[model samples]
Target: MKSEQGDPIPLWERSEPAVRPAPSPLSRDNIVRSAIALADSEGLSAVSLRKVASSLDAGAMRLYRYLSTKDELLDLMADAVYGEIVSEGPIVGEWRDTLRTIANRIRSACREHPWFIELLGGRPHMGPNALAMLEASFAALNDSPGFDTVDASMQAIRTVNAYVIGAVQAENSDLKNSMSKADWQKVWWPYLERLIATGNFPMLAKIIRDASHPSPDIIFDTGLETVLDGLGSQISR
Candidate 1:
């Protein structure tokens, strides 16, 4: 009802404003857009109705009309984040290839945002873009040879999504991830320095001495292929 600036905003707006409320000069879309920019620049912890309102020159209370709580706002934010992904490939191929493509697309979306992985599977059955992606997953299975049984198809979809979502979660983990990677590099470089210097750990040291680890993309592709291979066996039966 009331915005942080002490003005009234009804809540909800598309990317563009059709008509701006005179007093508050805000819409739901503007608030979300600004909030996204804030979150993208900062972290989700930095986002608040007050912060978004301030960015838009409105008041935080005004956001309450459409977004009752920050939780709702976050859901909206994640849904909004999903809208950014654009995957438009043919789905008529082998189910393995189809799902593989979908997983990569979703993974890349999470990778780019680095926020949606955790945002997903929370507050189930919410978020427009999230739902859309889920629907696409189910549709892919149904359109393939795995279409024999509903329960099996559902299980397969769920299993694949769990893996893809989990991959995103694993990649985006902050505290442990930072430490783990640093520790890996620490162990790797020093061990390589010594091993290469003293000629121990010959195999590992040789790979390390090659100037590049297998590379992140290579790792992702391998995991993606593994998941696809497992799925292929199920569908063929």
Candidate 2:
């Protein structure tokens, strides 16, 4: 495949190289795996061709045979994590249930690999595994009773996906700001209390004082259900 610039397209558009006659210590899979491990442990900024190669005990230049650029490495890593998000078996039960399962899995995957969220924006992913997860979502909505057309299904997928991405991004941002629960309590909590005391933000103050703070999982589940409810209304229309 070719790009607008007429260069041979890499990443999702190209096939992996043929396996060597003799097995080698390095393969695209291992390189991507090592890079993912590094990202999971240290974050995305810490990942580089050199760093991943060092983790695999291979020279950085050797990785070029399998991956041309760090962007390609990141594409592979993101795709592999999508593979993790896929359900092990076919999604059964109602459409809402299927979508719920899919949404939760995506949220879980993002939480596990915070770096995945960083790669999620700016460009679209068309990798095999990323497409698989998307297909599952489309299929779920397509099979719904009221979602009769491809366009309707596509719109539904985008809406739910937007919610999941936005929610996870906000959740991760909050987590990053506070070093720990104790830190949040000690640092942010007082600042928030002071803001509430000013009385300019009465609604915010009310929530701060009266609302019960649920675990992140619960908050996510609640938000997911609210989004699903909105979709459910449209479907019932």
Q: Say which candidate scores most in TM-score.
A: 2
- What C-alpha lDDT values do all the predictions have? 0.69, 0.82
Output the TM-score of candidate 2: 0.85
Candidate 2, number of clashes:
0
lDDT by residue (5-95, candidate 2, tens digit) is 9998856656667765443578788888899999999999999999998887767887887878888888899899988877465555677
Q: Each candidate: RMSD to true structure?
A: 6.7, 3.2
Model 2: pairs clashing at backbone N, Cα or C within 3 Å: none
TM-score of candidate 1 to 2 decimals: 0.72
1-237: candidate 1 lDDT, tens digit per residue: 556797864333223335456666776667778877887777777888899989888777766655678876777777776666534543446677766777777787776666566676666745566667666666767756667777877776667778787766766664335666677777767756866787666887666657565656676678878877887787677
Clashing pairs in 1: 2-61, 2-62, 3-59, 3-62, 4-59, 4-60, 4-61, 5-59, 13-29
